[model samples]
Target: MPPARSDDDTDGTRAALGTAPIEPPVAAWPAVGTPADGLTEETGQAKKPRTAAFGFIFVTVALDMLSVGVFVPVLPRLVAEFMGGDAVASAAMYGLFGTAFALMQFFFSPLQGALSDRFGRRPVILVSNVGVGLDYVLMALAPNLWWLFVGRVISGVASATAATAFAYIADVTEPDQRAARFGMLGAGFGIGFVLGPALGGIAGGIDPRLPFWIAAGLSLLNALYGYFVLPESLSREKRAPFSLKRANPLGALVLLRSQPQLMSFAVVQFLSQLAHLVLPTVGVLYLTFRYGWDTTTIGFTMAAFGCAAVIVQGGLIGPGVKKFGERAAVLGGFACGIVGLSMQAAAFQGWMFWLAIPATSLWGFANAANNSLMSRRLGPSEQGRLQGANACLQGIAGLIGPLLFSQVYALALAAPGTFPGPGAPFLVAASLLVAALVLSVRATRRPG
Candidate 1:
């Protein structure tokens, strides 16, 4: 871990990490610089989407996350029910489900991004929507825990299209506008946050499977909407041949190595992604065990968190970035995460937890800022690949995060009293963010 850099660059090598002004990558990949090397996929390409069409990407990611959010509060409970309400067994099984899901995403993410690069983003996105919709159907109908587990695997494969969606954003946006646009895209996640959990909690209260049905309808309907509204973001000439070498999980990591500057960012991002998984994997369970909250309470609390995210990402991100710059924003986000998660970890009363939501909500500014910065360093032809590489990191985090946090939580529960309590998972997450904060400082430092 030499501070992430291509220090060999003349002067611009220092630009990407500097605070005053950031320059483009001096050594952007030239091997695929032009669209010349491979046979392009035969899929018919539509023209680049209109500016208004940008809304489609936002909506697409929203619907995708919304479907995910709908089950967050209840999925663990459903597993618990199948296990005779044994919390420990359910936690272990849920971690396995998460790990299995991440395995699929790890394998498929680069493929999804590469496929979008070849065939175009529109079809790749639409197909993912359909796949997700159908997977929800499977989950809704699952008679047993393993059946639901299988559904999660499918969802991971489908959800890997998030890389493509980000690629779509890169395609349509200017370099300067990317950070703001990325923030707007995060607002989509916020929308899901606000609605999905609340809806799932209410619906899940009636029947744990009900939220999946609702999620299925939403995904299908979104697919239909996209079929009519979403056009291709990548033009035919801009398309690259589908390279299996860059499409698999291992190959995707090679893509990260291919760019020396991205290594540090990718590493920091992996830690951030690992920290993020705690909420989904153990947040609900932690709430249930620690605070005695029911399904509805968990959902509403999540909704509140979502609302804060919307305000920060949707409303404040652009102005914040403009005033503070991406590096500053990134630093601020990590600081917020450390404080917020620590606050959540220390909160003994349920009401104190509410104050932590906004701080954590603001943590997304770091991701949006980091993405904008990374996307600027690559060419259009490689945006998908870069995001694929990043998603591969996320897949790895997804693989590790769930098991680590869930097991920590379960172990804490088994403890007699004092150390590693129910708050243990957040404390661990906060620690990961602290590591990220340090790594990011090194990554963002100007080259010597």
Candidate 2:
């Protein structure tokens, strides 16, 4: 070939590398300063296209809540069926269920989030929905207590749609608007609680397993809707290649190291979820053990909590944001949580318990405001990253809260009754909220 010309040699080299024109690596897409990198989303200036994706995510997640909440009423009862009717054992089972879910999330949420960053949000979402649906079916058919454990384990791994959903919003939003979008998801959480539990309670009366079947069906339906309708939000150019460390929950620690503001917000997020973890797992156990209430009475009490959350998230959140600004709303919300915690801890009678309703309403409000604040702080590119980290933090709380509450409950039973009451956790959780309030005030303070 006559000592191949320089042009010919260059062409051969380029061909071997499969870049005849020297195309840039896909890493360049989300690289700092790239338009598609999600930086603009942090600005809270997402265009119409991003808004549409946000709406899609909201719908799918709402469906997830519908299934999960519907099953809550029956979870303990079903466990009792296997424990030879020992309530304590059943309660332990419930705590174990939460432990399984939270522990898995501790590892999985970040992985899913990072993967969505690379593979695009659509597939991860679709897979999660399917996994959630399957989880419901498994629980419904569980032949023994172990099966229930298996179902929870599987579901926990699969129910990570929230991570992908958050990423989708990030892909389309600006940093400033992230909080508002996240608040909308919180609304979905509230709505799911309102409808899911009420319906689950009713269905559970007929057959303890009925709610699980219904939830499974809904998850499958959600999967179908998602596969057909959810568009790809993270484009090929914007994804990061998957890394073990980045995909793990520890990624939050790694990513937050460089961003102190984000780290502070993440701490607040963890504490908030920690407070919640005490309630859902231990609250009902307290009512039943202390007051000897049945499913119907328990359902009514929880309904009160759920209804308040619904109204706060779905109805009042927008106005609150408009009136108070995100920071003020957050502070006010936390203040409400403090009040509610006090009410629940002080409740020695049913009427006093009712007072806790308004307090939880405040908790809902504060959570919404915090979410909105965090959203605003992120650039679009960082949305999935932060949300994933947030999920992991919640998972961490989930893991810690149940074990702590269960241990406390056990200790109270064991000692000459020293752990105060089921309300003790609420007291601790409340104090934590007060600390959170102080932190929020400091974080949002304007720099001189």
Candidate 3:
């Protein structure tokens, strides 16, 4: 028999007609485990575990990240091509592009969150996927840098996936189950980075626009997959009405503040996120300038980091959190970040730089830790808003991180008398982590 759709509205209509039990929808795949014995009494039917739904969300996240990753290697060069290959001018323009993208995310992500609250996660995610695909198409066909810029801005506005996806995870998973799932979400990021750049670089070597075309196809395909397979995690009773006032980015931050220790947790997330931006923003340039590494070598390093991330986030987080608890995991992750960034700052030898990858990869624990901790503070109705507010925080970090890292690195290079030299940015990033660790300690000490 065909599995019924799991839209919350449809769930009611079908139940009234005396159809199947009220379990979340999954595609008609083979069942793995026995029907859950735990929820049987309350639900009045044998319920398949919703981990299958979690699988769908995982694929959604991985594909979204892959699509975004496909363009990363080529974007600055594309901007440079528009600048007549003027490196300095292209650098400034690239920073502007990053800022503008973040600006759009800052303004729109809260609206996306509120919409998910009013409607449901599935529609919001579908819209985001379609928008991303369309945006890639626009970029691929762009005739000028400004046109590409517009495409980027649209992509930012379409950035609903992170907030909604996280909220969806929260809705389906139990409190104890959340950290591991969040780690899996982070693993999706690792998978994207591992595959996206290699594909992008190869395609880009043939034609700069080809990767964007590929990205477009991937996104559209993902949207189609979601349309057929993705179930609504949010139910009608749990959804809150959408509010423009609530959707305001500042208002979202206020929401974080209203909850106990939530603002402090936000601060910890912001600093850690900001610190982590060093790799993507200026990592390649730093390696070239300091270690005299070639593109192939840099690519391998990135792949190694990605693999390590997958191991740590996908495989290790659940066990580590289970044994040590979320608070210890949070602090330990920060500790790893501090040491890792410091290693990068001080590494004069190539092998020394490589060692930092595993250390830094373990820092993935901090992200899941913070997310799991914060989600517990909000009601199910407010989960979307909480994720939305966190999106705004990411936007803020995105706005600042790229520029900050670039300037610090650039000044380190040009200023001969300045100490720390090319390693200055890494040092600065490490310091940010140090601060984050201290704040996290205080945060973990307080009651929710």
Candidate 4:
């Protein structure tokens, strides 16, 4: 016979689960153990662990930025090389590249996020990384603009890795520790942003395609690393039922309406992305036209911005969230965005351009904090859905921001002798950020 239970033991078991014996909850991603199967209690075989899985996700993101930056320095020059130094055609082609990437991301991010939820995060990540590597190889091989568009489409699919990565982090981490992990990813982004462009600048000195080759190599390395080491975070039992319609970005809109807090985050996302909208496209062109910066100079200036951002978001931002609270961090980030844009508009000399460096760094710090706080508001069950929604909001902002900024950039270029030089669009970006600051301040009053 089985051992007899004492009366007290029976009562304790009853109390634990209303008349059933209860098992202790398992700790997730502990320092020593492999994650067990979704429905099984047994722990899996031990494997070598590296936090670089998280860093790999960020590297993918940073390389995407690098690919953009690499092309950026040589874009005008490359068009010239091919089209007999046609400044207008170069500008148009450059803008088209930006438009293609943003447009494809807008359409694909939610789809990838949903697919990861239904299938598993690891597979999605592997596929996306491979896509990005291929995108770079294509860019390197492309003889003309049409191939560049193909490369953008391929890269955009992989760019969704970032959203899936955040979902993967959510899957593995405890609620309290998530903000710090998210900050680590942000920091990785900052590091990549710093290194990729600097490398691109160096490659640009040799050949425009060199940066693409380097990005491809880095991406290939990431894909190989993930295949061997990165474990699946999403469990088969916990995954939501997959639907093609859910994969459609329109589902994110429905999610926005269902969750009030998510709606608020969507607003914050739109504002933050809008603030960044000017930087990648118009910002680079503005600096180049206004200061007569060469590719290396522009690359270094961008790298400085990335370096400062990495420091603040990686080190300071996480602690700020824990100390002052997410609301404060969000408000602070918006405020910094306003300051950064204003400084960019007001700066005259080439060196004065550095003023926007700290401004953008502060922006990065604050935005990181805000994203962490937003992620905290959702339950584990909804992590991928919520992150996918967030990405959709960012995608919308990216799509619209470029269109708006490109128009302003064209206007400034058209009438350079008149208007406020190239600084007019930046001033507009500042004004928009100021409005966003007020909105973020108002959001702090809601319940966490």
Candidate 5:
């Protein structure tokens, strides 16, 4: 019992039942010009919802950092367990562990960057998450120092996600928006540290190995989430062929040389990174040996530090930059770092140590500002390369910081009369921050 075949009825039927229009193939989509910040441009088909992408990236980074924070509070105690209560030997071995991680990062970071450039960001990031999960599992099962070292090596090789993640941000965000966005990214780190160390401390109190298993579980879950939701940011047409020449870590540094200003900024970056490394390398040990702090106390202190970071990086950085400009923010950040380091070095009372957290959190502003400034100077195609170079510098700092600070700490503990104090390493770090501040000031004075 169909309706009568009027023209209107026929038209309505066609509208309701006719085949839906087909979307253009991804290859056939028109390419759009992105902002002239030399970062990645989006094509029609490649453009997805950016807010979702940013959220995913933020969460992923937070989780990655969280796992790190969870283990840090227990790392020194775990080492002590293996070394028969010899603080000096434990400190020395901790340095070796850090060195192993850094060595792997130095060699592999550029390769990951280059791979992201060719294949895609999603696959590399997913793989990294999986690797980190497995590494944590290995560490959880480790019965001795050698096995622990193996875990660190694996983790380091898998930790190139940061650089690639930065490149992903560069691909999606406009130049003017990058600073604020980067600040938010820093916030993700802060939040991770906030939850990770605090929980790790509590969990470590129950059983030091429990946090590792928990961290592994979280990482594996992250990988699974990413496999389903993460989208490709780089388009095939914009991707460059991977080359061993560009993939070499030493060769990656050469790219910075091509931009003289970037080279100066790189040095500034290096000094800051080097100064910051003293904390994770020696913070737990120093607190344990000097202040006689337990795992829970160290974790809470780290959480406090993380809270400060969240406040500054998440809430204050954008306004600070808007009010003072990027250069001034960099200078101010370094100044805060010097003050904080000095406080930590001289802190005789436990409360004095807690007071330094907010001041040191301001140091993160320099990182976001400096990175945003340098990122703007390059084109889209170069974002991965630039991030890779920065990763190399961080790797170098990681390699040197633990060795220097751990040795200094051990030496101070071993011969309290001969050396200044266990805080000698903090003083050294403060000096490095001073150098970084001077360089940052000098770089700002130059004509662009």
Candidate 6:
């Protein structure tokens, strides 16, 4: 095992690796001709601006998530509409939609990341935003299942925006500041979730197709706003040539493996992402089966979950990281996940189910901390590639997660007396999370 890295050794590690120091001296940060110059000027933060480029990216992420959330409340019914109202068939078809999206993301994420590295963050992001807007419009106008599937494919291809967004964040922020910034980003997602589902449910209640139009409008507006205000974070000198070998998903994973410190964290990220799929895959079905929750009730529950996430990621992550360090934060967050999943699995009543939401929100701490850890290990030029690889990993997990959990849930439902109840998927999630926790602990303990 390599020796553990201390905070004090950060600069030394960067210097020894011949990489730019992760945290340059404050005086050097705003120096003319430095990479930070554009960021500083844009934010008017001679020091750290109150709201810098990251703030815009944060809003971009929030809006992106909001568009996604708006669709959630009505997707099942939409699927059922095409499937002749067979709930089981609709559920199966919905999993396929999710899988198609993930499959496209898996193939394209690294390509998008590599493109961002070569071209620039701004164009890639803007294009993705435009694509998402079109996708929403397409979904809204879909006349049949084929059209819906086409729309999903387009949406999946455009989903590469997330990887580019993370790469943008890494370009502008220092390593030590990354976790907090990522926490803020996660908070944006939380806020989006809070507003999107609730509003979507209301709109969906009135007209099932209304939310998609609204979502499409939001995506277009977001794209227009970004075109005017978003600045390029990657300096020309830092740009790398794009290569097909580096752009493929398998190639991306291989590139990730080239970094010893990143491999374990990547695996942990994969497992955690897979485990999280339980929420989207089985969450609605489980609730409906177990508690007879309707769309409105499920929307409210998701909003509440988003609220808890907002509180924890926005409010607690920075302090939690400061108090216990990234490793501890990661471990503690995973611990919370274990507890939350277990509680969710055992909860028989609605109130008991609600209680688990806040507990699971702690998982955001782990996500932000792990991202920070990984970001710090790479050089500026490598950020896009790394993030893209991570995105591909996430894509793979997303592809597998829904299918796995849905199958498990279906099987469990079919044999309720032999298996756990609707909450059986949570038990499976808890088990995966346990493995992730163990891997995280071991990985963090190892020296870089």
lDDT of 3 by residue, 182-251 (tens): 9999999889889988888889999999998888888888788778778777668668888889988987
Q: Is candidate 2 or candidate 6 better by TM-score?
A: 6
Relative to the true structure, candidate 2 reaches a TM of 0.80
Q: Once superposed on the true structure, which residue ranges of model 4 sit more than 4 Å away at CA?
A: 1-50, 74-87, 143-145, 288-297, 348-353, 406-422, 446-448
Better of 5 and 6 by lDDT: 6
**Alpha-carbon runs more than 4 Å astray in model 5:** 1-32, 35-49, 73-95, 137-149, 204-209, 285-296, 407-423, 446-448
Tens-place lDDT digits, model 5, residues 1-448: 9866786664454345431111223332223464223233445233333666678788877876786678777877888888999999998998777677778888888888888878877888889989989999999999987888788788888866788888888777655456667888889988997898777878999999999898889889888887778878777767778899998898789988976667888999999999988888899888987789997788778778878888898899887775456776788899999999999988978899888888899998888888876776666566778888999998888877878898988888887765458889999999998998898777666344
lDDT of 1 by residue, 249-337 (tens): 78878777755557777877888889998888888887887799997788778778878888888889888776557787888899999
* Pairs clashing within candidate 5: 38-379, 38-380, 39-380, 40-380
lDDT of 6 by residue, 412-446 (tens): 88886775777889999999989989988777763
Q: Highest TM-score, which number?
A: 3
Stretches of model 6 off by over 4 angstroms after superposition: 1-52, 75-93, 143-145, 292-295, 411-422, 446-448
lDDT of 3: 0.80
Ranking by lDDT: 3, 6, 1, 5, 2, 4
lDDT for each of the candidates? 0.80, 0.71, 0.80, 0.69, 0.79, 0.80
lDDT of 2: 0.71
Q: Which stretches of candidate 1 lie over 4 Å from their true place?
A: 1-21, 29-51, 72-96, 137-151, 204-210, 288-295, 410-422
- TM-score, candidate 3, is 0.86
| Evaluation by TM-score, superior candidate among 2 and 3 | 3
Angstrom error of the Cα, residue 169, model 1: value is: 0.2
* Model with the higher lDDT, candidate 2 or 4: 2
